[model samples]
Structure formats: structure tokens, C-alpha cells
Target: MRECLELAPDAIEVDQASVVQRLGSSRTNCENGLFQESFTAAQGFLAATARPRCVVQTVDLATFAGLYDGEGSNDRDTPLEVILERSEALALFVLTLGQTITDTIRRLFSEHDYLVAALLDGMASLVAESLVESLETRFGRHIAECDGKSTTPAVLAYSPGYCGWHVSGQRALFSVLKPNEIGVSLGAGCMMRPLKSVSGVLVAGEPEIHDFDPGYSCCSGCDTLECRARIARVTGPVCAKREVAWICSDG
Candidate 1:
């Protein structure tokens, strides 16, 4: 049975304003009356500055194994009906999570404290990122294919805030990519259903990527746009990273 990727649990922590007591000084540009306006502006900037994509790879599998003796799933298949069912099921799950998280934000923070709330939510996103590592560790951490078919090697899996990727500018990044496929939808204010979700590409390259290889595969195996595939090789490396972001869908 193939094992599915899972993230580290300790990664699931939030950074509320109190979280900043040590990290740095807090800034509140989002004051009353202006809170909504400030938020809207930030959201707009995030959307515009967000790199259409950061990473250059993607992944798809028919089956995955659980971490524990029995957790998520084991065998895998990609029948058309099964794919649709899985997509809908997972999308619904995302939507349900989005709704629950949105409700929490509304109840927890003041209108002006939205930014702080986003930080805290990003902390929660760390859990999802574990999969990036888990996949890398369990499978082949880097590029394994030699002929032409394999997963991409994630050099950096950056999200908002890490490299200037902020939460506000990502309003429309996650709109309809797969709303029906994964129950992801944008609220009137542009918040994704699962307020804790994020968006960012995984920077990757082939095993031979060294020196200044601009022509190198920046996207690994995300699309047919990367290095050639390995010959007759089926096994591949794992890919994982934290999907944390209070609402980090900038790009």
C-alpha cells in the first residue's frame, strides 16, 4: 500500500498579537471606521503582487496510505466517477471548513484586528505544510525520474509573508480553481470558505540543477514544462510543505 503524505502536528500553532510580543512590535494600521478600508486595500495589493505561481510543480496520485495503522486511506484508483466523487467530497470538506473558520474570525476579532487574526490563522496552516515534507521524506525527497515521468523537486514552498507574500493581496487567488471540485468559494468580502487555507506554488528543479541554470527546471514536474522524465522508472520522491496562512491565498 502506498502511504499518503501527512504534516507534522506541532506545526499547528497560531500567532495572535500576543504572539508578536516577542517576535516584534505590533502595528495596527487597521483602526476603526478605517478597518474595513484598510483590509480591502491590503487584500487588493496581495492579489496584484502575488506571483501567478512560485513553485513549478504539481502532484496527483490514485491512492495513499495513512500514517497510523489506519487513518485516511490506503489503495488508490483514478476512475472518472471516483475522481469526481473524491473531488466533490474533498471540496465539500474545504467549504465546511471555510464556513466554520469564517464564523470563528467574525466572533474572535474586532473589525480592526483582522490582520492579527490572519497571522494566527497562518500558524494553523503549518499543519497542512507537513504534507510537503512528509511526501518528500516518504517518497524520494528530490527529483527521481531520469527518463521523463516523476514528481517535481520543491526548492522553496513559499506562501505570503515569508518572502513578502502577504495575506491581504490574495483575495481572488482561490476563487473558482476548483470550487465545485473542493467546495472552495469566496465570500462577498473575498474570503475563501476555509479561511485558514493558502495559495503558492512550489519552486522545484531537477536533480542536476546546479550553478546558474536559468534554463533548469524551475517547475520540476508540475507541468510538461520541466526536465525530461526518467526511463522506465515508476517510484518517485516525496514532496511536502506547510500550507499555513490565516487566509494566505495571495498567489
Candidate 2:
């Protein structure tokens, strides 16, 4: 069954430090007057505008493998495929910060309020990520519950348009996940409509499954290489294994 999540704005937790970092400026060096004003305005706008929503549907490994390969153009040998093949469970999900935020961003840009617009744009990206992080944690707990075990599986999300998963792969994914039910639509080039939204599959398995060398052919063109930091969070010595719980609500 597909699960729906309606998250409160405060639950998204967009901290100023993270916003500053997302904006390409560190708090320590961010003393510019305009930057400060924009940052403050972005925070306020996000607080008033963010409407975090998510939909997730879990599928057996075989089903996901078909979806992953259905596109026919994806490089099956990529690190993302390797990690997912090792997963004990998988779920497809779409998360959006709602249309109002994107509309406001367009308005800001039209009015030449570039500074605040950029800051809000970056902050919205962070909030979308934060929503994914929360889902991963909750889904990890749900896995433990379903197995009737005390395991703390590491659940991480991987999307198309990166790591050799062709952007067109979204077609196969959207066919099954049907994000349009929650107002997220795939447009030309497979970009989600809200612009601040994210869609992907969450893989649950031992933390070690996520570890991969960054020397893969796909990694050559990638600039972010964000998987390293995410893997480190799960595999690090201080990584905590919390109990799993169901991610969807009856309400």
C-alpha cells in the first residue's frame, strides 16, 4: 500500500547554519549586510510557506529491479544499482515542499529580488533534503518493526539523473509511484513540477551495503559525490541504530 505523509512546517527543521552552507557561504565568513538581510527573509519565507508532503510505496526487491531496469538505458553496473541489489527492502517515494514555495520563488525572481530568491531557493532545497532524511530514519524503524527484530537498517535514498540512473528512468518510477496523486508531476526532462521537490527509492540494508569507491565511471562526471558523506553517516563509529517504526499514519 502507498503511504502518505503530511509533515508540519516546523518538522522540516531548516536551520540557519545549514541554510548558510547551502547558499555557498559559511556562517563564520557571512558578514555581508545584504546576505544577512536575504538570509533572514529567506528563513521567514520558508517558515510561512513550506508545506512538506511525502508519499512512499514499498516493493519487493524483484519488483524494484524491474522498475530500475525498465528504462532500458540505465547503466546497471553503477554504484547505485550495486547498493540497491544488496538492499533487504526498498520503497519508492516523492516529496515536495508544495507549489506555493515555487510560485513565490518565481515571483521573487520576476521582481529582481535575486538575493532573497536565491537564498529561499537554496533553503527550499535543504528542506526537501531534510524531509528525505526524516523519511529514511522513519523507514529504517519500520523495517525493524516488520521483521520483528531490533535491527537498525541503514535506509538511504537514490534518485535518477545521477549515479548512472538515467533521468528518463523517472517514467518507469512515476508509472508505479504515481506522484501526481500528491500534486507532483514529471515534466519535460523528468524534472518534478514543484522544482523544490525530490523523488527516489529508499534502500534498506546493513550500512556496509552503501559503501562504494568513488572511482566508478559514473563518478567521473559527478561533481557533488554526496554519497560519501551519506555513507559515512551510516557507517561511522558514532552512528546510532535506533528502533524502527511505521512511517505512514492512519490519519
Q: Who wins the TM-score comparison?
A: 2
Q: Which lDDT tens digits does candidate 1 get at residues 1-251?
A: 11112222233333334333433444463235554464444333332322211111233222211111122121222121122222211110121223344444454466656664553333334323433333332223334453244654434323322222233323323421334333455555445545544443233334332112223223332354212322111123532233432222322
Give the TM-scores of the predictions, in the order they appear.
Answer: 0.33, 0.92
lDDT for model 2, please.
Answer: 0.83
Q: Candidate 2, clashing residue pairs?
A: 141-244, 141-245, 142-245
Reference-based TM-score, model 1:
0.33
True-vs-predicted CA distance for residue 153, candidate 1, Å:
3.6
Q: Stretches of candidate 1 above 4 Å error? A: 1-97, 110-122, 125-154, 158-179, 187-191, 206-251
Q: Model 2 clash tally?
A: 3
Q: Please write out the lDDT profile of model 2 over residues 1-251, one tens digit for every residue.
A: 57887776665556778777877776876677877888888888888888878889999888888888866888746887788768898999998989999999999999999989988998899878867887788888888998998876989899988788888888999999988777899888889998888988989999999998987778887899898888987999887443222245436
